[model samples]
Target: MTPAPALTLARRQALINRTDMAGPGRLRLVNAAGQSLVSIELDQPCGTVDATGVALTDTEFAQVTTTGEVAGALLEDAAGERLATFTAGLASTIPAPELPLPAAQLYAGAFVRLIGAHIVCD
Candidate 1:
């Protein structure tokens, strides 16, 4: 398996917010290859992230959960598995660890961006 990336990568990835394609009030996690990995359902008036999705796992399958609040938002799985580390609104250039990016980890980084946060995927 490949390792994940640092938190800052979330702000760096190419993000395409196609809420129209994703239906109403939704955000997508897509790859460079244009694969929509996951879709998060959001209620605009509520001011929170609420959705559960079936995402591909190393073995078979897993549920991707999203939750948002005034403090912060979270995207995680049943086992409390997190794809990246996240912090909101990165102001400066945060250094990235010198490593290779595998496809799965890249998606993890995007998940952080979907939640509108700076992320770390250690």
Candidate 2:
């Protein structure tokens, strides 16, 4: 199957509802053209840059990668499948994850958060 055109990460400012303060909010990956790269649903964050990775539903899990300064994650589907990966523009050859993971998956947002907006509001 032909893969969807990959979009570069544009602003990691994920939306967090002020009302959902009680619970973890949803996050997404916006493209350079200002379009949502994928439809992400809420789930326990399944991403990390450390040595360990987060395990998703039944068997899905994310793989962590590093290049000294930058980090990335390879998203997996439930039943243990290699969907795609996100490398923080570190001159690596990691492809982006395919669209729409199950009902809910956590990879982009969880990893993106580590890079955040870079701007602090005092």
Give all candidates' CA lDDT scores: 0.29, 0.28
The list of candidate 2 runs beyond 4 A from truth reads 1-21, 45-49, 52-122
Residue 22 in candidate 1, Cα distance off native in Å? 12
Model 1, 64-115: lDDT tens digits are: 3332211112333323333322332223323432111222333232343232
Error of 2 at 61 (Å): 14
Q: Which ten residues in a row have the lowest lDDT in candidate 2?
A: 7-16
**Per-residue alpha-carbon lDDT of candidate 2 for residues 1-122, written as tens digits (9 for 90 to 100):** 53222211111111112212334323333333323433233343433122112222222222322112223333333322334444323222235222222222223423322322111110
TM-score of 1: 0.25
lDDT of 1 at 66: 30
lDDT for predicted candidate 1 compared with the true structure:
0.29
Off by over 4 Å in 1: 1-24, 46-122
TM-scores of all candidate predictions against the true structure: 0.25, 0.24
Please report how far candidate 2 places residue 97 from its true position, in Å: 11
Candidate 2 lDDT at 15 equals 14
